[model samples]
Target: MTEPLFKQIAALIEDSIVDGTLGIDQRAPSTNELATFHRINPATARKGIALLIKNGVLYKRRGIGMFVSAQASAIIQERRVAAFAATYVAPLIDESILLGFSRTDIHALLDQVAESRGLYE
Candidate 1:
């Protein structure tokens, strides 16, 4: 599925930081660079970066520029993992029971997934 422009941009920048394209203590691109690269408004770019900052994924360096937080990638991963559990697991479990699938059925499906994905040993 395609992501929205701002979200795509945010993910790209975040991934860059995590993968060392943007290092610790290194500054992120200015809003203008982001705007030009992504063909978006500077305001939009700023808002996207602001979202990361709000989530503790980035931090300002005042007179310098934005830097990846030491814990930024870990924080982002944790948030995403929690969101995934909420979005996928809780509802799936509720629906499975409502549709008469028991815990055994769920465990069986999980085992199938694990085996199919080579996660089972």
Candidate 2:
């Protein structure tokens, strides 16, 4: 089970925005609605929403509701890519070292896979 409820919520919301499941200028679900929908606490929902707001993914409209920012998808994508690299790469490097693999060996294998997949840079 995922332990970080707020972070999981944040990722779901961010993915919805980035993938156009949620649209620009569209009002997001209310905190109470989100809480109910995800079976989480209202405060947890608020934390997720607050993170998006701080990251410029959403904005409040006084007493109306929270709306997705025009640049929400872009911001979410940037954040996701950054987080993916940090989350995966550091652990991968540590694991490779523990498995008796050198950095150069890993880089060569990564390049091979990238080239095979036509993702080489």
Candidate 3:
């Protein structure tokens, strides 16, 4: 299933923050800019920005613009980690159990997979 447009916009901003494309105190793209760039409605783009503000990933600067919060990247990273566990890890565990894999077996398999991907360092 596809994610909603607003959520996709939100994820785009989150990725920018996490990847250092956006820095703390830096202004985010305005609603107009976002709408233009993504070919989305201004309202839809605003909804996405609103999500970030509500989550403390962004803050308004009165008359200036929305800026990345000082801790935005860290917060985004934490949220993504939790989301990954829920979205992928839990399902993997459930499927492993259904396949008669023991906890140890799952752990070893995960280790092997990580090693193959050079992610086990």
**TM-scores for all predictions:** 0.78, 0.72, 0.90
Residue-level lDDT tens digits of model 3 in 54-112: 99999999999899999898888899999999999999989998999998999899899
Local error of candidate 3 at residue 15 (angstroms): 0.2
Candidate 3 is scored at a TM of 0.90
Q: Whose lDDT is greatest here?
A: 3
lDDT of each: 0.85, 0.89, 0.94
**Model 1 lDDT tens row, 1-121:** 7876777778888889778798766788888899998789988888888888888888998888788888887887887789899999999999998989989999999999999999967
Q: Model 3's lDDT to the true fold? A: 0.94
Which stretches of candidate 2 lie above 4 Å from their native place?
1-3, 90-121
Looking at model 3, the pairs that clash are none
Who is ahead in lDDT, 2 or 3? 3
lDDT of 2 by residue, 4-113 (tens): 88878888888788778889999998889999999999999999899889989999999999999998988888877898889998888889989999879998989998
Candidate 1 TM-score over all chains jointly? 0.78
Q: Which residue pairs collide in model 2, if any?
A: none
